[model samples]
Target: MSIPIDDLPDIPADLIDEIKAFLRLDHDEDDPAIAEMAGSASLLCESFTRQLLVARMAQDMLPVKNVWQKLSRLPVQAIDLVESVAADGLTQELSSDDYIVDIDSDGQGWIRLQTAVSVSRVRVSYAAGLVADWEEVPTMLRQGIVRMTGYFYANRDSNDVHQLPHAVSALWRPYRRMRMG
Candidate 1:
């Protein structure tokens, strides 16, 4: 499960302007609408890649089945707090000494506990993402987002927003995080 602690980052002004230029709009009348489309496009790319383009804080409720448990989010930047939640809704915060964070070869996040946990579940508040800033996002992802936004703008009057262009997927496919069952 994912619980976002803050609002997602907005599409940068420069990028918005770039999209407007792609749409060949010299006027700012539709700037807000364009920005919204850009934001949606960014999220679409992020979802397809299963990666967060910007750093974000989120909490995950995970089962305590072993000493080391994999976190739901990848590229975990930092662990803010870890607590065990009881059936009655009480929470016990774990100490730093109780567990350690580990990043596997695949960049997956894991938390190793010194001892096995008795709790059925734990809530971990963590920061995770691929880049710290929007500017740090890869060029391919940015271009994919721009293209998707342009597509959305072009099809605003129809049901075509549900359709994702092949080019956008091609650009973002390399960054997709493959999950195994």
Candidate 2:
């Protein structure tokens, strides 16, 4: 179900042309139009190159697996445990915390976790859940919660961008509470 970069919508020719024009490639002889074009092309090329590298890395790291199919094979009790934990409603019986948890279909064929909690005020956020790989569940849970808490702790170092882990942790806390309860 994954769409390759080639399958994505084409970048607009007008935008490219506008970018080219904005660089003022036709100006001075020392910094001529050709040099400007080359500079612009180089920038664009580098962006695409980085994107491809990241895509490849992600593909290599995350292999395709039939998560739902495997989950379906679990015993009814185990399946219920997963459902309840994922749903987050089971937290109420275990804690008096005013938190609401919900699941969302990511449209890309995965489920995500959303949480709304009231401290001094109501705060809401969401976290992307891991693919249904039971073996990766523990690590994924930790990572996903961190991400939802607004902290970007990916396995690999990214382009110097740090995500907020607090938001991710907030979203995932309920699920953890439910499981323990």
Candidate 3:
């Protein structure tokens, strides 16, 4: 399960204006609505590519088992909290020495226990993504978001984007390699 500990980043208003520039239109009359479109497009692009455009805190819960298990999101930035909740509603904070975080698996994150516990007891709080702020988001992702926002804004009349666009595809291919199909 995925538990978000913070609010997802908002699509910057300036970006909405950039999309507007691309579409050759202007004014704050529709700025609020256009900004909303930018956010929606960011969501779609992130979902399609399985990438977190901005860093956020989240907790991923995994069932107990002897083997290693993958974390909920990609490009695992850091692991903050590790706790094991028992069947009788008891939660024990796990020591950092007890487990390992393996982000070397490309985009995927992995964790393995040093010792076994009861079933369904593992919980991990971590930061996962490329950057922590919208201003610091990668150029490719930002461009992709702008393009996607343009697509969404233009398609308001028809809603006919049947699939992900090629430019976005090219931007995401390498990142998608480690994501499970």
Model 2, which residues run further than 4 Å from truth? 1-9, 26-66, 69-105, 111-181
Task: Evaluate model 1: give its lDDT.
Answer: 0.84
TM-score of 2: 0.20
Q: Which candidate's TM-score is highest?
A: 1
lDDT of model 3 at position 107? 55
Q: Which lDDT value does model 3 have at 136? A: 84
> TM-score ranking from best to worst?
1, 3, 2
Every model's TM-score: 0.91, 0.20, 0.84
Cα lDDT tens digits, model 1, 1-181, are 6777756698789999888878898999888999999989988887898887898987888777557878877678888898888888799998888778787776677877665677888888888888998888899999898889999888889964666799999999999998889
Q: lDDT per prediction? A: 0.84, 0.26, 0.76
After superposition, the stretches of candidate 1 with alpha carbons farther than 4 Å from their true spots are 116-118
Going through the candidates in the order shown, the clash numbers are 0, 17, 1
lDDT of 3 at 149: 73
lDDT of 3 by residue, 36-100 (tens): 88888777766766777688877888887767888877668887778998788678888777787
Candidate 1 vs candidate 3: which has greater lDDT? 1
In the range 95-153, model 2's lDDT, one tens digit per residue, is 31322222323111122223332221211111122323223334434333223212221
